[model samples]
Structures are given as C-alpha cells and as structure tokens.
Target: MIKLCLQRSLRPAVLLSRSALDPAVTVRKVPIVPHIHSCQMGTRGRNEPREPLNSPKSAKDFIYSLHPKERTCLLMELQSFESIAIAQETLQPTPPTRAQIKYVLFHNSIPFVGFGFLDNAIMIAAGTQIEMSIGITFGISTMAAAALGNLVSDLAGLGLAGYVEALASRLGMQGPDLTPKQADMWQTRVSSHMGKAIGVTIGCILGMFPLFFLSDDDEEEKKKRKAALTAPNA
Candidate 1:
C-alpha cells in the first residue's frame, strides 16, 4: 500500500469522501489564486492600448524577450513626457486685477495746514512768540492755537500714512517689509513739511506781538507832544 499525504487547504476534498484520495497520491502544496489588476495608461508616442504583462504569460519571460535598445527607447520616451508635463504645470498664469493703485490709496489732494507737532516745534524753535514765549500770554493764547494746529495736522498725517501703506500693500509690498532706509526717509519728509508749515504760521503770529503793546489811544499823546515842540520852535 502506497502512503498518501494531503495538505490542510485540500481538506475539503478529503472531508467529502474518505476513499476519494488514491493511496499513491501526495499533495504537499495547494495552488494559489493569482491576483489580476488592469491599468489603462497612455504611452509616450502612441495613444493605443498595449498588452498587459499579467495577461497569459509570466512577467520574467516578457522582460527577458525585450532587446536593450527597445528598453532604452521606452525609458527615454517616458522621461520626455514627464519633463513636458512638469514644464506646463510650472508655466500656469496668475489672476489679474482691474483695481488701480491710485484708486486704492488717496483720491488726490491733501491740505498742508500748519497743524502738526513737528511744525509747532520748528516754529517755536524759530522765535515765534508761540514758540518763544513760555510766559503768561503764550501759556494761554499760543498754547491753544498751537494745540489746535497740531491736532488738525496729526489727523491729516494719519490719513496720509494710511494712503501710503495701502498703495504699497496693493503692489505686493507689505508696509512692515519696507527697507529701513526707505522708512526713515518717509518719516523724515513728513516731519520736514509739517515743520515748515508750523514755522510760517508761528512766525507771522510772533511778528505781530509788539502791536499788542501799542496803545490804541496813542494819537492824542502824539498830537500833544507835537504841539509843545512846535510852539517852542514858533
């Protein structure tokens, strides 16, 4: 009698009938179910479908049958296609904008009144009584005028700064990213213009200070002095 050995996977057959297996039969391994997946991909040159590697033959046999030149040509074609695809992706266009730069910033004119602090400081430094006198008159009158001027100037300055920032931001340059030199120059120019205006306004006010001390009734005293001096001459 021949000894027969069967594996566990084939136990269904064994369970069906005890005498089904011949005494001489030996089954050490069971056949595995092959997995098949199909992919439809376009190649470099032709748009037609190619035979799949898993169809009816083994992969090793298919690869061994290809010549060296044919393999190199296929690789080169695939590389060229990949390069073209990458180039096209890189060259895509950005969106356009219809809003103008000036429209986003200021409308046009900004008034240059003598209202900023820098202007006041410059005027005071330049001898305007508003800048010159820390005395009672200046303390009351000039201070109020100067403060009013500066407040107006400050509000206007804020608007100007906003306009500039909006313009820069629209052009893709954030306000904070401006170069240190550029920022310094902008601040300096704003300060300089405001200072000039304050200086002019304060100067005109200070130039008229002596007139306040002049008597409105001075003509009577002037006539009396002139009469006495003229009689001596007579």
Candidate 2:
C-alpha cells in the first residue's frame, strides 16, 4: 500500500484526488484587486490650471486677505493721505478781485469818514480840557488825541466793512442793478449806515458838552488872573 500511495502521489490527477479526498484540506476565496488607470492617478488629465491661494479677485478681496495689523496700518495710511489732501485744499488762499475791493470801499467810505470826523472832534474837545487842566500846550495834546481817535475809527471801519460784505452776501445782492428782492437789502444797508452815522455824530457831540463847560471855566479863570496881574498899582 505504501508503494501504491507513493506511485499515485507522483501523478498530478492522483495528487488532486488525494487532496480532495483529505478531510483536513480546505479552500479560501481569493480577493479581487481593481486596476487604477493613469488618468485617475492625479490632475494630469485636467484642462484648467489651479488658482493660487494668495490670489485675489478685487480690491475688497485683497484687503481681506491681509493680516489684521497689516490691514489696519494700510487703512490708517490711506486716511492720513486723505486728510492731508483735504487740509491742503482748504488752506489754500484765494485772492480777492479788484471789483470786490472797489465795492467794499464804495459802500463803506461815507460811514468811515463820518465816524472819523466825529471821533476826532470828541477827542479834540476832551484833549483841550486835559491840556487846560494839566497846563500843557493845546496843539500837542489835541494832535495826539486826534491821531489815536482816527486810528480807532479806522479799525472800526475795517471791521464794519467785513460785516457789510458778509451781510450783502447773505442778502444775495450781487449785481449793481437792484431788483425787487434786493430792494429790502439796499434799504437795510442804507438804514444801518445812516443810523450808525447819526448816532455816533450826536453821541460824540453831546459827549463834548462837559469838556466845553470845563474849558470855559478854565478860560474865564485865566482871563480873571491876567486881569488881576495887569491891573495898575492900587
């Protein structure tokens, strides 16, 4: 039997039969492995290029991609430049035209002259009394006081000129011709000047009354002293 078994095992069909007939031999199902094609391995077969992560589509998008500190710095720089430009635009001076200068002078001249005369007159009257009281020369004190009063009047005229120009602009009176709308504006301007001139003139003239009385008393005293000194020996 050993010889026969050995001979059978030497043949392939007898070995298969022997393995099939054995109770301990078992068979297992083989797993199937799918083949991957070259095209599916990567993006080698794609038609479009990939976009970069850092690439932006618009200004707003570019700003969003920056770090928080960098974005804040850039915004601050932009605001600073904007503020500088605005300041430069606002600070630039515009020269006034000749027509505007002429208009100002024409409208303000009468009041300025009237105020100057009244002011000088009052100052001169006051200065005469001061000189009499202090026993100083009338010419020097009167001239100095008149100069100071004229300076004051000139400053006042300058201020009033600016005010009148602003008022005219507010009233919307531009051209030389007066429309119905400008009628009220003209009346207001004229009335203001007239009233100011009248008030200043009357006030200054009245203010000189006390000085006049003092000067009269000083003159009378001087005359009496002179008469007493020049009288013949008695």
Candidate 3:
C-alpha cells in the first residue's frame, strides 16, 4: 500500500509516506513540488524565496518568521504593489464645474424651443380644420373638435421627435466639458428643467401668430352663432 503525504508551503511537496505492499517491491522516496504564482511580487532576486500572502494574519506571521535580510526584500516587494494601486486611483477622471453645467442647459433649451412652437401651431391649425370640416357637419361641439385636434397633434409628435433629435444633433452647439457623473447631478437636473420651462413658455407665446391673421368676418359669424344658440325665443 502507498499512502500520499502533502506538504503545505509556497511550493507544495507531495511524497509517498508508505512502502509498496508486495514483498519483492523496493520503495524509493520521491518529492514532487508544484510551482504556482498567484500574483507578481515585483522583481525577485534569484537567491531569495517567495512566501504566500493569503490573508493579513498569514502575511504577518510569515513576515515575523523571516530573517532580517529576507524580511526587507519582502517589504520592498509589497510596497511596489501598494504604489501601483495608488497611481491607478490618481489617474481616474474628475467631475466638471458649475459654469459648464450652465452652458449645457442653454444648448438643451434651444431644441425644445422649436418643439413647443411646432406643437402649439399644429394643434391650433388642426382644431380649426376639424371645427369647419367635421364639427359643423356632424353637429359635434367645439370641445370635441379641440380634443380630436390634440389627438392628431400627439400622433404627429411621435414621428416628429426623431427628426427633431436628428436636426439638433446636426446643428450641434458647443457642449459642456463635463464628466458624465457630474452632468447627472441634482444642480444640472434643476437647470435642465428651468431651461425647458423657459423655452416652452417663450415658444408658446410666439406660436400665437395664427390668431393675428383671422378675418373680422369670421369673428362676427362666430358671435352670431353663439347669440342664436343662447337666445330664449323660438
């Protein structure tokens, strides 16, 4: 019978502890060492040996057990790894400044100005057409015509979104020099909201141009219709 024995070290040495069972067999002791490198411990001297650093406790124990000269060699190897980690962290990117966020907010507002103008213009024009073509013929109310116009406007917006994005990308303005994490902060979020509100408000005011071009006759006709409907006499 042959029994296997395992030696625990940086390089494991396996040996057979028992002799062969057969009476004629002769047993010879053979040591097998497996070399495994878990991590690079910097440049090592040919004469120096390596120790396993599996845990803080284990590393401390190994260092305390070493001779003074070998201990210094191991300390130098560990310091090399620590310096590399610090250098990597130092090279990481930093966030941008407040002024850069403001610049981004201004450019973001520009495309939305166009969107608000087109939305209101389309809604008013479609509502007018619906009032003339469908509401009068079918005896539908003005509110119903207006709601239908909004539905049409919303459908048009779905297709218009892609074109608006494409156009804005082509006509790109100077963007903020900011890291992605910095741009996603609360201050930037609030700035974007303010830009959208201001842009849409300005655009909506400009979109009321259609109201100026209406004929006096059309206004008079609408007044007559309302008067006739509200009158008590048959």
Candidate 4:
C-alpha cells in the first residue's frame, strides 16, 4: 500500500518536471507592476510642506492642536476685550468768558431804571445805624465791584482802541499805536486807583456813622461828676 501511495505522489511530480523541461512550450509574459510605495507620498517632521486646510471646516481641529498655554491665553484675551468704553456722562461747567464777565460788570455798574426792591433793600440796610452786618456786606460788594470794574474798563479801553483802529483804517489815516508798556501802565494805574478809591470811599462812608452812642448810665456818670464839682465842701 505504501509503494502504491509513493507512486501516486511521484507520478505528478515527474510529469511537472517533464513539462518544465519541454522546449516547444510557449510561456506568455506577465505584466511587471511598478514598485509604487504609499509611504513615499507622505512627508516626515516639522520641515514637511503642509497643504492649506479649508477655513471653518478644520478650525476646531486646529484649535485642539494648540498648546494648553496658548489656548488659555487666547481665551483670556478674548474675555478681557471690551467692545466700547462706558461713557461717564457728566454736566460740563460753562466757564465765564471775557465778554460775559464784561457784560455782567457793566450791567451791575449801570443804575437800574426802576427802583429795584433788592437794591432799595440793600441801600436801606447799608444806611441803617444798627448791626455791623450791613457794613461788612457793603464793604465786600464795593471791593468786588471795584475789582470787576477795573477789569471791564481795561477790556473796554482795548475795545475802544480796536474801534479807533477800524475807523482810522476807514479814513486811510495811520498813526503810531500805543506801546504794550504804555497799555500795561494804563491798566495798572486804573486798577490801583479803582481799588484804593473804592476801599477808601467805602471806609470813610462807613466811618461817618458812630457805632456806639452814650447810654443812660454814661449820662448819669457825667452828671454825678458835674454835681460833685459844684457841691460845697462836705
């Protein structure tokens, strides 16, 4: 049985060897596949050229790849950004301009046409021989008026000079202008005189009224002295 099996296996092997040895047999050429490696298409490390990713598509992926520090910093900066500065709404103070100051001074200096209740009250209060309150108030008012008037007059003088220059130009008559020194001297003179005159005038006027009057006690004291002098030796 073993010999029969060996013969059966060797019969096919002998036939294949005879076929391989045959010179008359024609063999068709199989096409040679090119050695194309998939790995060769992929680039390596940091220097590798990357294709641009589509926007809004791989944005999450790009963000996810960022370092934790960079991600936190970006988020913090975004959170701290303010869209607009909150405005502090406030009322702006309107400072007094030169013209306004002048107008105010001039208005106060000019006598009112009608009897002003306030002015009359002021005058009556000032003229009274009573409390010292009126005197102090009048003094302050006088000083303030004088100071403001001095400033206004100086401004008015300048305005007059301007008007004169305008008129002179119209008349085609040019003249030497006042020097800055002369103008300063004039202003100083006016201010000093106004302040001193106002102060002195008010002082003198207030001084006219005696603050104290002799009471009954003083009169009695005088009478007693006179009676003692006239009395005969006691």
Q: Best TM-score goes to which candidate?
A: 3
Give the winner by TM-score: 1 or 3: 3
Q: What is the lDDT of candidate 4?
A: 0.35
- Model 3 Cα lDDT, one tens digit per residue, 172-230: 56555554445556777777788888778877777667767667876577656655655
lDDT of 2: 0.43
Task: List the candidates ranked by lDDT, beginning with the highest.
Answer: 3, 2, 1, 4
RMSD of each: 34.2, 41.4, 24.4, 44.2
The sequence of per-residue lDDT tens digits that candidate 1 reaches over residues 1-234 is 000111222353343323233445554543433322211122222222335555334333443444555434433433333334333443643322223222212211121222233333433333333332332233345566456545544444444433433433344422132222322354434544554555456545543444454464544554465566567769
Query: What lDDT score belongs to each candidate, Candidate 1 first?
Result: 0.37, 0.43, 0.56, 0.35
What lDDT, from 0 to 1, does candidate 1 have? Answer: 0.37
TM-score per candidate, chains pooled: 0.20, 0.26, 0.52, 0.19
Worst ten-residue run, lDDT, model 2? Answer: 36-45
Give candidate 4's TM-score.
0.19
Model 2: residues with Cα > 4 Å off, grouped in runs: 1-125, 133-184, 220-234
* Stretches of candidate 1 exceeding 4 Å from the true structure: 1-187, 206-210
TM-score of 2: 0.26
Q: Which candidate ranks first by lDDT, i.e. highest?
A: 3
Ranking by TM-score: 3, 2, 1, 4
Which 10 residues in a row give candidate 1 its minimum summed lDDT? 1-10
Shift in Å, residue 223, candidate 3: 7.1
